[model samples]
Target: MDKLKLYTNQNFDQLRQRQDPLADQAVEDLIANPSFIDVINSWDIIPDQLSPDFSPRVRNFLQFYFDKQSLQETSVLQNGQDFFAKNGDIYLGLLGFYSLPYCYAFGDGAEVLVRSKRIVQDIGKRLAETGVFVMDIFRPNAFISDSRAYLTCAKVRLIHAFSRYFIQKYARDWDPKFGKAINQEDMLGTNLAFSMIVLRGMIKMGRNISESDFEVVLQYWKWIGELIGVDTSFWPENSKEAFELDRLIRKRHLKSTEAGKTLIGALGGYYKGNIPDALIRQQVDGLFYFFLGKEASNALGIKSTNALSGNLVDLVFRFSGWKNYGSKKSYEGFRRMMEIQQKEQFGEVIKLNLPQVIRS
Candidate 1:
């Protein structure tokens, strides 16, 4: 066996022991890349199933996210071109939905993150040596991280999309000065349906606001999911809270889920940028439905192994928050963390506007 393939396979074994879907997805991913597989398939797959019991629907969705997306302009990451692809940002953004849930259920996401980082590093190392562009590194970690970043960027992008789509649909007069009507379909991608599902999860947790506010994004997501034949209720729908509370959290992002008065606290933060007394629960109620037996799960093409992939993210909402003055003051905190991430990767941040017109 080639040393590199051996190294990667060993890493995958440890990942399998942890029972991670993203890691499982990574192998199939590496194998899918013509070049990467060309070299590794000769090495023989040990256990065969990298992630046993992966859902066909989700596996297709995740693999499709990697295969189809890339970064869009206004991306905070300077190196955006190096990371994202068509709908890449949304794909990565959905991955972030799992962070709070995973952290609560899995304890520390560092192992997963490290494994992810390793995938990125290995892919980078491989590409760097050959100077070959294998369509977004073709590595498992890159798949997860890119997918995560895609999710985060999706939230921001969808917010931008919401701003645009909402204006076009309802308030055409309220312009943010970007330009004339944008092709919402062109801007957000078919994946926006799934992205809407994510925003829905964020909103459902608190039940603090109207689904109408973000339903445009959801509509777009539905279009995309349907294009690929996925169920519309990809997110938790039945146990959702009221709209008013959901709105409170979306505008203002509370740091922790296990706090009190989350809506009140989120409101203050939305209006003002201050952390209120909305006590962030030290422990997020991660698996209310997540940790529950399989019977309790909504199971949108998920399994015990693949559960890490957005299958349980709505649980982030289950963590209660206190709506203290301080908490409301510090809502919509997604900005700061994102800014920090850009700043940290400032050196590697690469920016370029891809021509929307792909030449034949």
Candidate 2:
């Protein structure tokens, strides 16, 4: 930790010159965009179905960003199917991966943003094979690997690392875009990412049921509980998407059927890193994608997961609000987020630090 601080001091410009010159340019270039500035200087995002909607400050922030007509015109329901990525809720939600650290790094302290941008640039290089936005690598269509074994291992490792950070850090927000929040597309996007991580890894591994694979798979579930503030069991019993995910996970992991009871950890215990078994089993919406992907894959006779992942964009793009719907409201803590928005909206002396509120 101390080493990181020393390396990324206020004089980061000077620091980067000494260590990496190319990365310095990339970060410098990305930070210079007009939208980037607006995102950084903004506050809250409005709720879709939740009550007490956007604060005046957040409304003003949107005014600078997406005017009412602009945002509305791109609605998934109204726009037919082309509303997911190019111009709608999914795009807005994904903006966190695209715009954060660059934007909300200014959330708590200015240094968080600086260090975050540095982290993104650095990680971007180390995992250039993976992707800055993780879905590309972990999905079915990353690289055509030299060996099938390497692809399997890479997918597993990538998914494990992603879920670990996602549950532990990504959901943690100094602001909406900065941290991982359940508010992300009303759980649609979150479920999709989680389920896909497991399925992609499993498929890459040739649907193997090895112990290590089980461990990582379980870790996926434990992490899911860490980030999702709900009864994880709602998946297998309640939602069809959840049921399909469980079915695939079970079929792939059939060997350990008896000991699977231990795999179910209390949400709090799972979050604390206690392992009864690897808890990566909450398949979220894995079934939908899996069925859709398999049907497509079989039709194409494609063996590589990366190929399927690649086609996901082309396939899902036809639906505008695939990642949308709405969400329930949370009881904001004592500080009152509404008050902060009001103060900032009217140009009152204030600074918005979402970390002070947004618990998980």
Candidate 3:
């Protein structure tokens, strides 16, 4: 199959350097349009339907979590930084190869993603940008104040517009079950995967996150969701609500599909090619199985367990947890390590920018 040539040839940096006023205007118009709101409202079940009241536990947790002095401090920021530092690769793999492919398996989106051929590269670029966004959002004075945040929002709008285009261009090919490529439910599900699913993955890997830090991380994504035009009405206020919503969304949308399996195979193949060491590759395979569990891994055609390597990975995580617990210096070291890794992976932390056109 010929690869789709849907995106402009210009790179994102070039696109930003030569900003087109018309493109900018189109994005602003899309964000302001009421059609998005109508689509969100059309959902059969909203967040409120799942959890109407913010439970006392959640309320109290937030009250203390967001106390003025706490916000003034950098402990929460450090914790957020430390999380990625310790589990950056694992988090990226889970989202890109595991959670995302699982989501893509739904309807024609899988067809779209798998057929693109550039999907793996696109995922890599997005993951790199996401790490930048995470660091910026959690930095003391940079949350919502930084240019990276603004650019991230712009990129999101462009992606969302591209989804709208796909839905219109291929209306006949669309599946009612999935609604559209970037439908409200799917958008919310993506957000949940980044926060709730990520948290779950961390725990599975034996990382310990404090309650306060966890809430703050969710809050950060909630703000990002709002900025990117995700309906505020469906945003979960706390982890408990997020978990419930995650479960409900998965139950409604997740099913094995051939397109999904193909996409997963493409992603796995990409990783296998890049990772030369057989032992490390085997451990990564185990990690995928561990992260997604038996059912999801099987659906994606990921191989069964490498029990020894998997257990070894778990043991390493446990040891790291034991050594790093409550140690600020340890977290600081991890943060620096993560920064170095990002620089190596992406080559000098390129600024986030809006794409001139959709590439995938």
Q: How would the candidate models be sorted by lDDT, starting from the highest?
A: 3, 1, 2
Best by lDDT: 3
lDDT of candidate model 2 versus the reference = 0.28
- TM-score winner between 2 and 3, please give it: 3
Candidate 3 overall lDDT versus native: 0.52
Query: Distance (Å) between predicted and true CA of 130, model 1?
Result: 26
Comparing 1 and 2 by TM-score, which wins? 1
Measure candidate 3: CA RMSD: 14.4
Candidate 1 residue lDDT tens string, 313-355:
4333222222211233221232233334334534332221111
Candidate 1 deviant stretches above 4 angstroms: 1-95, 98-193, 209-211, 222-337, 345-360
Highest TM-score: which candidate? Answer: 3
* Alpha carbon lDDT at 89, candidate 1: 26
* Worst lDDT 10-window in candidate 2: 256-265
Residue range 1-360, candidate 3, lDDT tens digits? 111221122321122222223223444443445343333323322222222243443233223312322233344445555555565545544565456655654533465455444465565555556655555454434432233334345455455555455454655755544444555555666677777777776666566756765677676676666555565455666666666666665555466777778777666665665543454454555666777777777766777546534456656544443443423334345445546655776676445543343324
TM-score of each: 0.25, 0.21, 0.64
